[model samples]
Target: MLKNKSWWSQTIQCHMQNQKSLYIFVSVLFMMGVIFGAIIVNTLDLNQKNGLINYLGYFFRQLKENSIAEPSIAFQHAVGDYLKTVGLIWILGLSVIGIPVILILIFIKGLVIGFTVGFLVNQLSWDGLWFACVSVAPQNLLAVPALIIVSVAGISFSLLLVRNRLIQHRGTIYPQFISFSFLATGMGLLLIIAAGIEAYASPWMMKEMIPQVSWITVPNGS
Candidate 1:
C-alpha cells in the first residue's frame, strides 16, 4: 500500500513538472517567432521600406484627420477577427494532433505583433517609437498576455489528451474536457475586452500622438 501511494505521488509530480515545462517551451517558441519577424522587417530594402513607411504614414495621417470616428464599427470588426482565433484555439485544444498547429498559430500571432512594432520603430525612429508605445502598447497590453495564456492552456490540454490516449489511462476524459472548455471560455472573454480596447481606445491614442510626428525637412543650403 505504501509503495502504491509513493508511486502515485511521483506520477502526479511528474505530470506537474511536464505541464510547467510545456508552458515554458511554448512561450520560448512564440518569442523566437517574434524575433524572427523583427529580423524580417529590419532586412527589407530601402525602396520597399519607403513604400511601407508611406503607406503607414498615410494611414496614420488619415486617422488623425478624420473627424467622424466609428468605434462601435471598429469594435465589431475587431471582435469578429479575435473570435476567429478564439474559435480555433477552442476547437484545437480537444485534439491531441492539434498541439503543433496551435503552437504555430501562437507563433504567427507573436510574429505579426513583433513585425509591426519593429517596422514602426525602425522606419520612424524616435517618433515611430513613441507612436508604437502610445498606439500599439495599450491594446496589446491586454491582448498579448491573453493570447499567451490561451495558448498555454490549449497546448497543455492537448498534451493531456495525448497522455491519456497513449498511456491508455483508465480515467474518463469528460471532466478534463469540461475543465479545458471553462478555461477557454474565460480566456475568450478576456480577448473580447481586448478587442474593445483595440477598437475604441487605440485610435484615439494614435490621433493624439500623430501631431507629435516630426516630418523630415530639407535645408535650402544643402
Candidate 2:
C-alpha cells in the first residue's frame, strides 16, 4: 500500500513540476474572469438590478416555503452538469484547436460563480455574506479545484499536441494520454462529491440559515 501511495504521489509531483506554468496561467485567467464578473454586477442598471432582485426575492420565498426540488433530483441534475463539463474538457484536450475553447469554459465557470456570490453580497449585505458562506462556498471548495486541475491538464495536453505538430517530434502520445485520462477520472470523482454536497448539504444549510438572516423577507402570500 505504501509503495503504491508513494508512486502516485511521485507521479503527481512530476506532472505538477512539468505543468507549473500552465497551472499558473489557467488559475490567473479564471481569477480574472471572477473579478470581471463581480465588476459586471456593479455595472448593472437600476432596472436590471431591480429585475434580478425581484426574481431573487421570489426564489427565496420558495426556498423558505420548502418548495425546492427533492435532494435526489437535485443530485442527479448536479451530477449531470458536472460530468458534462468534465467530459467536454476531456474531449477538448484531444484536439489541438480546442485549447482556446477550454480556457473560455474555465473562465465562464469562474464568472458564473463570482456573479452569484457578488449578487448575494451586494443585495443582502452581511446576511448575503453569511448565506453565500453556506450556500456557495461548500460545494465550490471541491468543485473549483477539481475544475482548475482539469483545465490545466486539458490545456497542457493540447499544448503538447501543438508542440509535437509544429516540431515534427516523433514521441508517442499514448502514455501522456493515459495519464490525462486518469486525471480526468479522478476529477470526476471529486466533482461527484461536490455535487453531493451541493444537492444535500448546501440546501440543508441554506434552509437552516434563511430564518436567521433577518433581512430575507418572504413575499406576502408566499
Candidate 3:
C-alpha cells in the first residue's frame, strides 16, 4: 500500500512538473467557455428568453409530477453519456490533430454547464440558484474535475506523440500509451460515480425542493 501510494505521489508530482501549464491553460479555456455561455443568456431576445422559459416551465411541471425517468434508467443513460465522452477523449489523445478537438470538447462541456446554471439563476433568482445548486452542482462537482484532468491528459499525450514523431524517432510509445489508457480509465470511473449522483441524489433533492418553489406550477392532475 505504501509503495503504491508513493508511486502515485511520484506520478502526480511528475505530471504537475511537466504539465502544469497545460492544466492552467485548459482550466482557463473552460472558464472562458463558461463565461461566454453565461453572457449568451443575456444576449437572448425577449421572445427567445420566453421560449426557453416556457420549456423550463414544462420541464419543471414534469419534474413536479414525478414523470422523470426512473433512477435506474437515468443512471444507465448518464453512464453511457459519460463513457462516450471519456472514450472520445481517450481516443483523441492518440492522435496529434485531436488536441484542438479535445480542447473544443472541454469548452463545450463548460459552456453547456454555465448556460444551464446561468439561465436558472437569471430566471428564477434565489429559487433558481437553489435549484442549480441541488441539480447542476452535484454531478459537476465530480465531473468537471474529471473532464479537466482527462482533457489535459489527452492534450499532453498528443503533444508527446508530436515530440516522438518529430524530435525522438527511436522510442516505442507503448509505455506512454498504457499510462494514458490507465489515466483515462480512472477518470472514467470517477465520471461514473458522478453519473450515479446525478441519477439518484440530484433527482431526489430536486423533487423535495420542487414543491417549495413558488414558480414551478404543479400540473393540473399532479
Candidate 4:
C-alpha cells in the first residue's frame, strides 16, 4: 500500500512550489523591465526637456501663486497621494474590491509613468533623462511586482468569501497574510534600492553627468 502525506504537508509543499516559481519568474521580469527603462531614458533629447521644463515651471509658478492665497495646495497634494496609496493598500489586502482596485492602481501607475517619461525626455535631453531614470527606475522595478502580488492575495481572499471552492477555511487568513508579506518584502527591497539611489547615484549623476545648464543676462553700459 502507498503512503499518503497529511493535509498540512501537502499544503506546505504547494506553498513552497508556488514560492519558488514566483521567485524565479518575478526576478527575471523585474530585471528586464529595469534594463529596458534605463536604455530608453538614455536617449531623450534637450529641446523637449526645455519645453517641458518651461511648461511645468509655469504650472509650478501658478501653483505657488495660488498657495499664497489658499496655502492648502501643498497639504492637498500630500494628503491625496498618501490616502490613495495607503487606502488602496488596505482595501486590496482586505476588501472585496481588491483586484479591481489593483487594476485601477496599475492603470494610474502606467499613466503617471508615461507622463513623467515624456516630461523627462522633453526637458533634460540625454543626461537629465538618464539621471531621472536611474533615480526612479531602481525602486519601481521591485515595488510594482509587490503591488500585483498583494492584489492577487486580495483576490484570493474575496473568492473564498464568495465560494469555498479551493479555499478549505473561510476563517483562516494565513494565506492572504503570506501573500501580503511577499508584497511587503518587495516593497522593502525597493526602499533599500531607492534610498541608495537617492543618496549615492543621484548625487554622482548631478555632479558629473548633469549638463552645466545656465542662462546669460548681460548688462549694457556704454
Candidate 5:
C-alpha cells in the first residue's frame, strides 16, 4: 500500500510538471501573438488598408456562391499543410540550435494570423468581424489548439536535446523522441480534421453568412 501511494504521488507530480511546461510554452505562443498583432496595427498604411477593404468585400461577395471546393483536394491541401508544419517541428526538435528558430516560426505564424484578423476587423468592422468568425474561426478552433500542443511538444523536445547535448545532462532521448513523434501524429490527425472543416464547413458557413451580411461601404481610394 505504501509503495502504491508513493507511485501515485510521483505520477501526480510528474503530471503537474508536464502541465506547467505546457503552460509555459503556450504562454510563449501567446506573447508572440501580442507582439505580431501590435506590428500589424503599426505597419499598415492607408492605401494598403483601403485595398484590403476592397479585397475583403470582393472576397465575401464571391464567397456566397463560389466557395465550394472538392473534398479530396481539400484533404490533400490540409495534409500537405500539416506536413509542412510538423516537418518544421520535427526537424527543429532534432537540433540543439533549432530551439530559437522553432520559437521564431511560431512567432511568424502568430504574426500572420494577427495580421489577417486585424485587417479584416479594421476594414469591414462587423461584416469583416462576422466573416472572419465564420470563415476563419471554425478551422482554427481545431487547428490552433493542435498547433499549440505540437509546438509546445516540439519546443520541449528541442530544449531537452539542447540540455542533453550542450549542458551535458544525462537524459533519455529515445523515449522523448517517441513521445514527440506520437504527439505530432495525433496533432496531424487533428489538423486534418481542421482542414476538412476549413474546406467544407467553413466555406459553407461563410456562404450562408455572406448573403445575410451587409458590408460597410469603403471610401473610393481612401
Candidate 6:
C-alpha cells in the first residue's frame, strides 16, 4: 500500500510538472502574439455576416455535402494538405532564432489560428462555432501543444547556436538531444491525432449522426 501510494504521488507530480511547462510555453505565445497584435488586426473591424464570411460558409457547406456523398481521393488529399502546413511550421521553428525571431514565428502562428477560427465564426454565424468545436478544436488542442514544445526548443537551440555556445565535446549534446526528442514526440502525437480525426471522425460526422468525437470507432456495418 505504501509503494502504491508513492507511485501514484510520483505520477501526479510528473503530470503537474508537464502541465505547468506547457502552460508557460502557450501563455508566452498568447501574451506576445494575439493580445498584442489583435488591436491592429481588429482595426480592420472584420466580423460576422460579411461577404467573405458568406463565401466561406458556402465553401464549408459544399465540403460537408461532398464528404457525405463521396469519400474520394480529394478528401484524403485535403487532410494531407492541412498536415503539410503544420509540418512546415515545425520545420521553420526547428531552425530557431532570438526573441525577435521567436516572436515573429509565434505571431505568424497566431495569425493563422486566429484567421481560421475567426473566419469560421464569421462565415457560419453561430453554427460556425459548433462546426469548429467538432472539426478544429480537438486536433488543435494536441497540435498547439506540440507546436509550442517545438518552438521553445528551437528558440533555445538557435540562441545557443548564435552565441557560439556550442559544447566542445559530444557529451554535452545529450541534453539538447533529449529536449528535441520530447518535442518531436509531441509533434508526432499531434499528427497522429490529426490523422485520426481526418480518417475517422470527420467523415463519420458527416455520414452518420455523430459529432466529431475522440477515438470514436464506427463499425463497418450498423
* Predicted candidate 6 versus true structure: per-residue lDDT over 14-106, tens digit per residue: 534755664476557655564444344344445533545455444444554554334445446645754564455445544533445655666
TM-score of each: 0.84, 0.92, 0.91, 0.50, 0.80, 0.58
Best by lDDT: 2
Winner on lDDT (4 vs 6): 6
Residue pairs of candidate 5 with colliding backbone atoms: none
Show model 3 residue runs off by greater than 4 Å.
Answer: 1-13, 216-222
| Full-model lDDT for every candidate | 0.76, 0.88, 0.87, 0.49, 0.72, 0.53
Model 1, C-alpha of 6: deviation from truth (Å): 32
26-70: candidate 3 lDDT, tens digit per residue: 999999999989989999999998878777777777787788899
lDDT of 1 by residue, 1-222 (tens): 999668645754554465787767877887888788889897899999877767676676567667435889888888888778877987888788887888899889778877888898887778888888877788778777667766777777787777888777756778767766765666677788988888888888888887777463212222
Q: Per-residue lDDT of 1-222 in model 4, one digit per residue for the tens?
A: 123235434644554466565445444544454445445544557776455566644533443343222324433443344335644665665655465665555555544555565455545567546755664465455445544444444455555555543445446666656655554444444444444544444444433433332121211212
Candidate 2 per-residue C-alpha lDDT over 67-139 given as tens digits, one digit per residue, 9 for 90 to 100: 9899899999999999999999999999998899999998998898889889988988888889999999999
Please report how far candidate 3 places residue 7 from its true position, in Å: 5.1
Number of the top-ranking candidate, with TM-score as the measure: 2
lDDT of 1 at 133: 85
Candidate 6 stretches greater than 4 Å from native: 1-26, 31-51, 67-102, 122-125, 162-171, 203-222
What local lDDT does model 1 show for residue 146?
A: 66
What's the true lDDT of residue 177 in model 2? 95
Instruction: Provide the global lDDT of candidate 6 against the true structure.
Output: 0.53
